[model samples]
Target: MASSLNGKVALITGAASGIGRATAVKLSKLGCALALTDVVEAGLSETAELCYTEKVIVAQLDVSNAEQCDLVVKETVEYFKRLDHVFNCAGINPTAYPILELPEGYFDKLVAVNLKGTYNVTRSTLSHLKEHADCSFVNVSSILGQRPSKEMAAYCATKYAIIGFSKSMALELGPKGIRVNIVAPGFIDTPTNASVKAGPEAVERSAQSVSLGRLGQAEEVANAVAFLMGDEAKYINGSVVEINGGLAY
Candidate 1:
């Protein structure tokens, strides 16, 4: 069945690739108009072309920039006349390195993109979302957020922060009828993990770690985001729907 999101408007960050791109396509299939933003202009255009509808607007945006976040949200609201759902998926995953061996600036950069970036977009669109009766927000976290990984301390920290931020937003927005939720994906087969997947042994080890005996796909995560944004998840605020193929728990 099609979701109640039909004809609704959604803004998605990092919509150029991976789970973000998949979510854009999925939501479009449900008859949602999309405002897709990413730093890669060409990739954003490619994603826009693949969407189910021509109501897609592509913008090159750096989610870490507060001004860009505000501008994009303003433009989307102006164009769409209302904002219904937001998917904050723009983030960076640095090379896995132990805390002691991590570069000086790497931690700050990841936090800026992964944590503060989510905050920036949410803050920019919170008021506009309030104007709608059935609005929602879905933030993309990761399995590392739920369980710490040995060499991914910085990435884990940012993902963990996302859950906390999402829960707090859910609490604050619930009374206003704007639901907030999160999705934590694990070992998704996407370009973002091209280097990791290049190693045959790494892929084998990751697959074995999951009970499902394989990695999750971007479409799987996208489906969860769509559910959280639709009426089927009307009472699912403050929830963290993990899509890790049983890798974590």
Candidate 2:
């Protein structure tokens, strides 16, 4: 498995923390050259340090900006000389609230980051991916995208849209050997959930809510992503791999 990814190039967004950070580390260990980006400059540098290799480049990027997206993709390709995989892990989840009470700017912000951001990165990388063999894309969505929650209307909408967008891309790009897939993770124990896990009872409560009786780890999702990006999953495209420990079921 490691030999297969060695020397290949991957571009990962949201590489500063959470799933993105975990994925970047995992890929680096497999000997893949990495172009890592996130809006959080410090965290991105921290992640780059953890990679601890000259094969990695860290960039501060906001996926929502089309021009920035193009620049990052172009620069990564120029640096690596080839692009094999893209992991769109940059996203935001605002505090849950009912649609009526949701802040006026909140929905727009979420849409811009979660939905448009994914599109921007994918658009910028599509042509490059098409030129490469065995290329693939893995987008990060959430369980809320598949199963809606009472106060997560905006989040759900964006995630749901990701599934649709990924499927459409899978169809359009499959012929060119460019695969696209989505990962819907649930209750991942990342910094984004620090507030939810603050109390002593928080972990237990979260565990009980899932059928697997535990919270998912960022590395666990990274495992799924790694598989999807590799030759083993070459036959898998336009599919949504739910790494939620059967939470939605």
Candidate 3:
């Protein structure tokens, strides 16, 4: 039996690990061909090997660069023939500290990879997606996008920007048959969160806030991304789906 996403092609950034890696694997099993990009070439290729279904192709992509964004999209189109889905999952969270205590450069770097990077990837894929008709862009925002925390100001800014960008794209591209959406995950336990887990009180506080009383898995977020990208979401767009186990509330 053919899956709903059969024959589709997808490009996922930050594909080396965490939600990105999980999304790539899920989409592949659902019958989508994959193009994987990340600054971590070794990890990206390793992820590709582990995918086990249509093996994802690894490409060194630094989404902070518009040229690399353009190249990645162009290469995916050349390889897969048509672009059907894109998941902008690449992001960074620097040291957790008060806004004033953080360096201006830290905010700059965070915005470059998180906000501007999504802009770069989504904008580059726009033309091809329009040509393909009925496609989707799923951006990985954070629960911090909707709420503020004392120690994570800059990361929050970019994630919040993703919701704004997704809404605007839905308005701009809806008529063009391109669906744009956002997935804002909260307290996800990825490698980056390992540091938080090491801090006993910090991890405890983080987990206590979630309704589920624990951290989220990367696969959980990937499931939402896959749903938004698949045909089941054909009627949905311009929506911000929160997968934080009610942590934001």
Candidate 4:
């Protein structure tokens, strides 16, 4: 267990599964209490149970809903008495379509969940985080944010916007001892994208494109996230830590 996070309280969004669940478990192992939220209630409860912390709270949250984000944040602070860390890990899977063929509604949905969702959670937590020292926030972006793929213009746009948003927030909050950073993962094997990795041939081809010749794991990404939220990464604000298994692109 890491003493640096002992007795701290962390609010994790998208805690139902994948990177979010892995991160919640990681923090709990480090002696951090947790407030886990996701739209999937059953999975959220399962995550809460897997956490080995003294205290854990679960909420069914849709990050795309601003009111829900605010309410959840308030509930977390009230339950834990303080919030020292936040992980905006809630997001929907990307829909790939060429720019010319993409639906406007899908683009709006992507922006709502990927970009504005981050904003709502961050805004609601800022006041609470500002009061504490060594507070940190980690927003999950994707390798797609930097490297574009065909038929993913809308998804890429949303991801790219998140990086800009995180950098701006880092600048605004760094002065107050609040650090903001991003973890850009590539081809991470998570439940959210199980279909994409369903076939062995698809998985093999994906692996070959990475210098490491493998897909990244959610736990691997969570490890990087844990570091960013700890005091050891105090000087790493406004940085993007890539966990893409050395993508060939």
Q: Of the candidates shown, which would achieve the greatest lDDT relative to the real structure?
A: 1
lDDT of 1: 0.90
Segments of candidate 2 deviating more than 4 angstroms: 194-198
* TM-score list, all predictions: 0.96, 0.95, 0.94, 0.96
Clashes of 3: 0
Residue-level lDDT of model 4, residues 122-177, one tens digit each, is 98888898544889999989988988888988888888999999999999888888
Per-candidate local distance difference test: 0.90, 0.88, 0.84, 0.89
Backbone clashes in model 4, listed as residue pairs? none
* Native-referenced Cα lDDT, model 2: 0.88
The digit string of per-residue lDDT tens for model 1 on 158-232 reads 999999999999988888889999998888888877336578787888889888998788899999999999998
Number of residue pairs clashing in candidate 1, backbone atoms closer than 3 angstroms, sequence gap of 3 or more or interchain: 0
Error of 1 at 42 (Å): 1.5
lDDT of 4 at 195: 36
Clashes of each: 0, 0, 0, 0
Off by over 4 Å in 1: 194-197
Ranking by lDDT: 1, 4, 2, 3
Ten residues in sequence with the least summed lDDT for candidate 3: 191-200
